[model samples]
Target: MAGFVNVRRDVDDKFYRYRMPILLTKIEGKGNGIKTVVPNMADVARALSRPPTYPTKFFGSELGAQTSVDEKNDRYIVNGAHDATRLRELLDAFIDKFVLCGSCKNPETDLILTKNEMIVRDCKACGERTNVDMRHRLSTYIIKNPPPKKGKKSKGGHAEAPSPPNKINGENGDPDGEENGAGSDDELTRRIKAEAAELNADTALAKEDWSADTSPEAVERRARALQSGIASLAVSNNGGDDDSDEDADSPYSQLGRWLQENPGSSAIDVFKKVQELGIEKKHKAVQVLAQGVFTEDVVAEIPKYVAIFAKMVTSEKHQKALLGGIERLAGLDYPDLVPSIPKILMQFYQADVLEEEVVKTWGTHVSKKYVDKETSKRVRKASEPFLKVTEHFRCTGNRAN
Candidate 1:
């Protein structure tokens, strides 16, 4: 464990085969120009079978800072000065979410974007296909920039591991020694070189020298932190259900009755009634209007109400509530159309009922705030395909310009 650590630091097995280099970070520049650079990001990314940009971008997203990727130079930077320990903790968070298999907790997973646009982690170790939580901001990044499809095949027909020509340390994969001052033979530089060399080495010794920490309390602490992070995604509620009670006096009921009374009412008429009822500012009004205004053909009917939705969705909270409305519309009211969520979302986006950032945020994680846990999950899972394709188009469009 001199230059490497167990992939699953919680598993205290002395013989754990999966290992990766210790994360090394260097703080560069001063004041407003300060940044944290990971010189050995390529080596660590290789060990995880992911693009170096992923963890770099994840760090930026979590820190609310900008990130820069220098694949050609083997340098990844996150703007603003940060401590190495903080970055290491964030790296652990990344590994738990993206790298380790959800079933086996091993770093032997392949990210596959499905036809429906959902990202699945296909674990080679456990034979399990687990869906990645798309609610994370990093999911958009992964969708935009997928990992290289497959490794190159060697002469023997086996796919050789990727060997990037440039390493932070000048020896093994390093092309130029001057970048990051990696050419100097200082103790830290030598250690980084050794770790980089170990990444490319396929010898049996490298596989055997892995260690883990088995302390139950330590493992529990890490698990609690991760759980807390996931729990934070959900908004606070008084434990009331999303749907309001139906009564003759209820504003939602009044609106529903008005909709039923005026079958041919236009979006403007609906807006007038919504304002008259004093429920236009309520988030749940979006849900009520979605159910009341649309029929069995919700997808076809969505275009008719885009103007109303635009007027109603005046804030981020309203946008989220609109998504919640769709969850209930498709998930509870018309379960049959749950499969058509991507189409539904596309229509919403095209109609300006939803913004790209809001949809991306909603798609990343499933929350009980919108509906019942199972129903919300079903809705978000169905929407993944659309989210993926949307991100892909945005990325390609940027490059085309």
Candidate 2:
């Protein structure tokens, strides 16, 4: 029989049993003999005794048994039935070592073997999900391969020689020699000189344009454009016709002529004329007055208009325009106007309807202007009551801070 044999012998009055097999019976469905017979040892032994020949193999191993090391390597190589069993354990170890959450960089994640035929990992920190199969392949490659070590320097104060660059494209010179060069040094120097000359010409032209003179005719035309609507007014009879005509025809010429013709006229007279203009015409008059104020020609008259805007203004549109004018005045760095800021802020506070965004906007403006620590603290504290009132009315989106 192509099977096993048993030999019984006595040595020194002690009997010994030796069992051997030539062929084993293959199980019905399982491929190999011993594995098909029975999985457990006692059942395998029972199956072996009842078979035509006693099978010496265990779990399909020709040596009758497999060592733990051989089985592990075989499991790695086969990669089908036995390998599937060990894959999860290997994946768990890889995830613990390498994988991190994409959002929070946390490694605390759970592996969920999804039914959609994919391995997915869920991050506990930031609730991000990642593909485990991709991460696994990347992790395995990283684990198997390591980075190259840097070379150590040579002794005797000499550094290790750098590796020669590889030649490409059939270059004639050494591969590293001027590989990045685009042109010769003489070509670059010529290009730089040409660019510098172009820039110098442009700068000289700009200076000449800026220094060009504004003729008296251009000044007269600008004044006539400003006085287009007021040209029909009857000339005042209190002055010489030539000078009065000049004053009546041009606003700016009138101001200049007044300064020269009636040097004794007080600033209050000029201010009174400005205030007498209709409200619709006041903006242009105010702009002209602002120009005069900026030039220190009519600075004494500015305080009257400032007082008028502060007290006489009731309409919100006019108040806003007045505030803009005050902001312009503040930009002039006039020390005399500094004390009026707190009064202006108080007026804005009284006039505004305590709307949340409005209060916050004004509050921010106040904070920017009031640099004194105590004054800033007081202004911020004063704003809190209004902010709270706005919140009580369900205006929560406005942020004052």
Candidate 3:
């Protein structure tokens, strides 16, 4: 009776520890009004570190039905008859899309709303913040009803000082636990009357309740709150207003996007663009350019950017950056690029771009910047052909010396 199962589909292997409560389905009603209910959705969502509404909304989206959550009662229902298996399958999709970070594939992440309202995932496991795909239907719902922000951890692991006290209570003349005379007493009376009027609305009481202010400032405050919430929702449903804003903001990213878009563009053109952008001529920056520019078809297109690579590896300082960037550009599951890497290094050698020692050391342990540790190891494993070529050159050169 472990009562928990791993979130991932590792049924064949029972050693997984990332566990969550097994989905429980409770079918209710009948005919057209029938629905599937999940009693433990709140618990399951807590295990996933997400709001219950997110998975509930996802169920609605996946099943092509309406969904509702009675938060006070912890009841989640979908307007269809869904079995535990189907719900679990849909839950996996939600976890993959929202919970898991695209870079590290870990669930320890915080979904952040940027100033411009774009949703990005900040990976706790990896210090990387990447943009969330704005195309999902649940993106809007998540934004509108974002889960409460987790507080900073203190040494004792408790939440950062509890959230501010209620505004009504704090507005007293003696907020620091002491009482004031008529001013404090009058404010308390108004606050209480306002709460009662809100709960039991009567036209007579609403008019009498002085705390339910109809002033311009109060109206403006409410309007602004509504607008801010609407803006957040709009951002969730729609993508960024300007896609090129990031490009314009960062020259490094600008060059990357430009290079990726125009593969046939010349090295002279790239160098000129780099100069125009006021980018530093540091080899490290060039390595960044190499990473940003060439993302796909790099094996075939590597030859075209020979001049760019040549400039990048001109000095000893650029050697490590260029090699590390190369590892990242074609690190894993790219068999075609493995052999080409040796030939590419040879071409760089013939052009005097990379010194023989640098090429020899290229066989050393892989760079872990681009890919994860395990993937970096596999990438180096795939680079055996290139390593052998470099070793042959080293032996031949030694014989000549």
Best by lDDT: 1
Residue pairs clashing in model 1 are 116-385, 117-385, 134-364, 135-364, 135-365, 167-173, 167-174
- Our tally of clashes for model 2 stands at 4
**Residue by residue across 1-401, what tens digits does model 3's lDDT show?**
22788876644457765678888998888765678899988888877777788789888766645577787788899876778888999898988888888897777777775544446888989978887755455764444334456776422222223212221111112222122111122322332333334434456523442332336675454344323222221111121123232243555555555654454455456666775765433444555554544433454344455545543343455665566556555553233455466655555544334555664565566654546677567655665665565444332222110
lDDT of 2 by residue, 294-375 (tens): 2211232332233223222323323333333333343332334444454434333322211234445554554323133444
Query: Which sequence of candidate numbers ranks them by lDDT, best first?
Result: 1, 3, 2
lDDT of 3: 0.55
TM-score of each: 0.41, 0.20, 0.38
RMSD to truth, every model: 23.6, 36.7, 28.8
Candidate 2 vs 3: which has more lDDT: 3
- Candidate lDDT scores, in order, read 0.63, 0.31, 0.55
Ranking by TM-score: 1, 3, 2
Over 4 Å off in model 3, which ranges?
11-15, 152-401
Q: Which scores greater on TM-score, model 1 or model 2? A: 1
lDDT of candidate model 2 versus the reference: 0.31
